[model samples]
Target: MAGSRVLFFEHTLSIKGFDKALEALDWMKEEMCKEKGFSRHDGGDYYDHLVATAQDLLDVGIKDEDIIIACLLHDSVEDVEGITVKMVAGRFGENVAHMVDLVTKKPGVDYKVGDNLKRYLEAISKHPGASLIKTADRIHNFGTLKNATPEKKLRQALETEKYFIPFFKTCRGAHPRYAKYFFRAKTTIEPHLWEIKEHYEEIEQLRDQLRKQERTA
Candidate 1:
């Protein structure tokens, strides 16, 4: 698994020049360790999610090394620990950094969560590379939703249906090679979302019943 991980990293780094990309990759490894959401054994870091998506692209015959690398590094600058797009660009070159920048959300924008999600979906629709990474991010997030609170799980499901599904559909139309994987991922996830939605409703009803019983008592 480690070898496969290294090969994927090398494959991505090869597009921008081996040594420079290696340095950036090393920095990224350190950053991944520091990041809050990264999983040590499961490869559940945002970068790992991107890698999984890139693997799907590879399986579908999309062999653009830059795109693959871009997919891998897509969330590194934006969501990883203490890394910046400028640093990625300076180390790995502009194209890679630009791809990362496209997907990175600005910190503390003060918008409502709904508005921020909308803006993010719009940004992904406008850029294929960003869309690719975002799709992978959603997939990983949905996969992990079982660990989240009932309220959070419901919100995530609604967000995926409302924002990500359409964006993934748009991305599929724009990038035909990835269409199959995107659809397959969507198909697998929809059922899970339905289950989560039902679970949330049941929890809410239980809470309501408890409140009513308390009032009567």
Candidate 2:
């Protein structure tokens, strides 16, 4: 039901000062569309994913309008060509831009290798607003990961267990105003990760069984 309730550009623009947020959304949509083949794992429009991320924040009772705006454009700097923090600041004010910058992965940093990921998570954790939006973003990502490849699904599940679970735990203490929401997100995400992990284990077992049968035959 939440999927069907996405806050469209028209609806969001009417929300008082959020009219400016439509500019960011427009820019994001244009850039994402221009980058042909850009899409969710399920082949849905990528802009839909951004809208869903913002809606997740709202559904969880987040009242910080800037955070919502940040969510709407969070991936722009990272995934969109020529988008920059300064560009975001000029349009949406500094706080929203700062939150977006905080979540964007730094250039040349391989998140799956070495300390890059740790430092990235640390930066986000230091800013509660960024962490809030990042959490919502991941919640959407994990929820829709069923359409992802098995390798990607396993990798995400493992990463969530290794990094996100602990991060969400700390958020309860560090972001008191949002603790309950973080907890709810954690509870929802963990079970799904468990299911993925279990599914993979079953697959591995079946592979082993087939190998043993082949040798015996």
Candidate 3:
């Protein structure tokens, strides 16, 4: 008994602390508002985008407060130059920061985007919460991909089918209720999937132009 001095543990519930998580969501939105999304004023509404991603998580049965917090902060580190993973960890707790950090792509460098994206996808696949957030991120992004250049949209669609749909399926398997909710959002976007290929000719021309420019540089 003397040797068994002390051992204690605590359990936390999302339902209990989720209100605080919403407050962090507001903070993340404000930071993102000062930044651009996929592009400038055209991507004018990051707040809406972040909210939509969060809503997707909610719909998919991800009620963990930290995961929800990660959803709100996902893009901030990737898109906003000054923001750092440490800052998020400091504010939201390391668990939330680590999840967000897992999904945040590193700042641009000379390396190939394709290779980086493959690595990014691999990392996301390892974490259930990260996978869930990314799937929501892609689902919302697909809805808005029309705002991207034809080439960009086509590339994204191909990648989504190649990589993301599989990850979404994994997320779907994580919970019994998730497949239904995830597919409900998927149905809304399935109607638009055909359009991603509509501008192949234009996209190819744009790609040729960019390739020529790259070669010249």
**Highest lDDT scorer:** 2
If scored against the real structure, what TM-score would every candidate get? 0.76, 0.91, 0.71
What is the C-alpha lDDT profile of model 3 across 1-217, one tens digit per residue? 2112111000122345576566665675567663544433354646566666776666556768788778878888888778898989888888988889889877664223566676787778677778778778877888877567766777777776666666566556664355665465456555566566655766779999999999999
Error of 2 at 137 (Å): 0.7
Model 1 gets an lDDT of 0.69
Q: lDDT tens string, model 1, 27-135?
A: 5566664265566344554445555666665565665555666666766765666678887777667877777787777787743477887876777667666666667
**C-alpha lDDT score of every prediction, in listed order:** 0.69, 0.82, 0.68
- Model 2, range 32-66, lDDT digits (tens) per residue? 65266568878777888888887777667777778
Candidate 2 weakest lDDT stretch, 10 residues:
1-10
Score candidate 2 by lDDT.
0.82
For model 3 the local lDDT of residue 170 reads 58
lDDT of 2 at 178: 88
lDDT for residue 119 in candidate 3, whole number 0-100 = 72
Error of 3 at 71 (Å): 0.3
Candidates sorted on TM-score, descending: 2, 1, 3
Q: Which residues of candidate 3, in runs, are more than 4 Å off? A: 1-17, 34-43, 108-112, 170-191, 198-217
What TM value does model 3 have?
Answer: 0.71
